[model samples]
Target: MVDTVNDDTELFTIGELARRTGLSVRTIRFWSDSGLVAPADRSTGGYRLYDTGAVARLELVRTLRELGLDLAMVRRVLARQATVRDVAAAHLRALDAEIRMLQVRRAVLRWVVRSGSTTEELRLMNKLARMSAEERQRVIDAFVSEVFEGVDPHAPGAHLAEAMSALPTELPADPGPEQVEAWVELAELVGDEGFRQRTREMAVAGARGGEQQPQGPDPERIAEHAGGAVRDGVAPESAAGGEILGRLIGPELSAEERVELADRLATFTDRRVERYWHLLGVLHGRPPMPPRVPAFEWLIAALRAHARDASAS
Candidate 1:
């Protein structure tokens, strides 16, 4: 039923209300018909007449509509079915999600432009950007599971399995193009059978519990010695290289331990595995660590040379 107006309240026709509120007559009539802004009374001529309070209501409706509220939600607000505060909160959440999606899309498109991506690549990146957090996590989880399945979790270097598998529960809400690219490349790397086998070799060697297990090396000494050797072009087989190795690992070591250490390092040293951690660090905003594989490779070669020389003597 239409609301009645008291004699104390002044009424305005639809045309008059439109002029006062700076809204069009057709819009006021449409809103009136939609029950969002109803007439307070009707004249004998049956023209819609609204009281002073209708002006305020019409302004509220116009403001709400301009702010992207559909007629249905506006009607609910007018009918007291939901409060403006509650509706605003819900809309805020929706807007936040939309904003995040737009940010990701912007980043992805920028990457596409910068990279001159092919059509298939564009399609793949778009699909990745649209995936939910859980979906992204599942991709990593499945890769980790396949690589480490049936392995003894408590074995040596087994702890690395978990660390290697650790992916953020979600990408950052507004991930950069490089981060997205990291994820895509990481996904592809993890799916490669050769890469999987390499990782498995390391895991199995670690699980063997002998001298074949992976070990941590001091980064500072390696940078000083092995890294310096590479910089100075000191060949791994040279006498100078042997002296550098002695300083790094100590001159007192027996040939057998040297040989065992060399074998153990060979089993675990993989450029791709190091790359996986490096990519993850980039994603998580960590300071970039210098590549250690080359240094270690040199060390392995030097150790093998010393073992050979010892055997010859």
Candidate 2:
């Protein structure tokens, strides 16, 4: 097309317009034909010429298309329903959530490999990974029964069951790695011989005619002294053994009572039983106890040995 000013004509052709906009004539012609870009004027020879505004509109359309906007989305952007910034922000959030899920799956698979588990173990992993809240509660319920069996349901054993059975009864949709790890550890612990035997001993003890075991007796004193001696690395046959036993059983306790205390502590101060409570506390998120029963068992052994020696003398 020709623009005339002061009787001077300046002519621009279709190819000239394409060169000015840094676009191809074929592409410009296609856009123009599609009604997306239009010609400003038609020359005497019938060539199409576009004004500068057409170039700017074409640039916007190309930018939107390059940004993953389909023709429909590009139309929406052109019509101003949503901004590219808003759409990009929403997509960023969706991508971040996807990345987090993939990370969790990666950790889970890594655990499986590290565990070197059997096919059955692998199946269990998948089942536990997908367990619903109700299903998780059922696991806790079964553990509770196994641990609390033969104990007075109304006794302290029942309280222990309620306290230690602290699984959420349902895992959340997106449990953190710690929660998942906790469940795995708890499952293994409940099936352990140490934990089961500990609970069973406590239950048997409870059924033996008392709500709570008596405290402050000579047996308690002996257990404390004997227990401390073992924990502090004092040998049962050491000279200090007599001192610890004397402090525990006292000067008033007869030789007969001292021997009786030895037998009683041997029966009750079981290390495995103590460990059961420790594992239960971990499951229930309770405060921990310092392990003392191994030391006590050592003391009981020492006391009984002394009793035997005294009888021989």
- The candidate scoring highest on lDDT is 1
Tens digits of lDDT, candidate 2, 90-118: 66775665664555455457767666678
lDDT of 1 by residue, 23-48 (tens): 99999999889887778779878888
Assess each prediction's global lDDT (C-alpha) against the native: 0.81, 0.63
State the displacement of the C-alpha of residue 95, model 1, in Å, after optimal TM-score superposition. 3.4
Tell me the lDDT of candidate 1: 0.81
Screening candidate 1 with a backbone cut-off below 3 angstroms (N, C-alpha, C), the clashing residue pairs are: none
For model 2, the stretches where C-alpha displacement exceeds 4 angstroms are 1-130, 146-150, 155-158, 168-182, 192-198, 211-228, 254-263, 266-273, 283-288, 309-313
For all candidates, the clash counts are 0, 1
Q: What is the lDDT of residue 207 in candidate 1?
A: 73
- Models 1 onward score TM values of 0.73, 0.49
| Pairs that clash in candidate 2 | 133-170
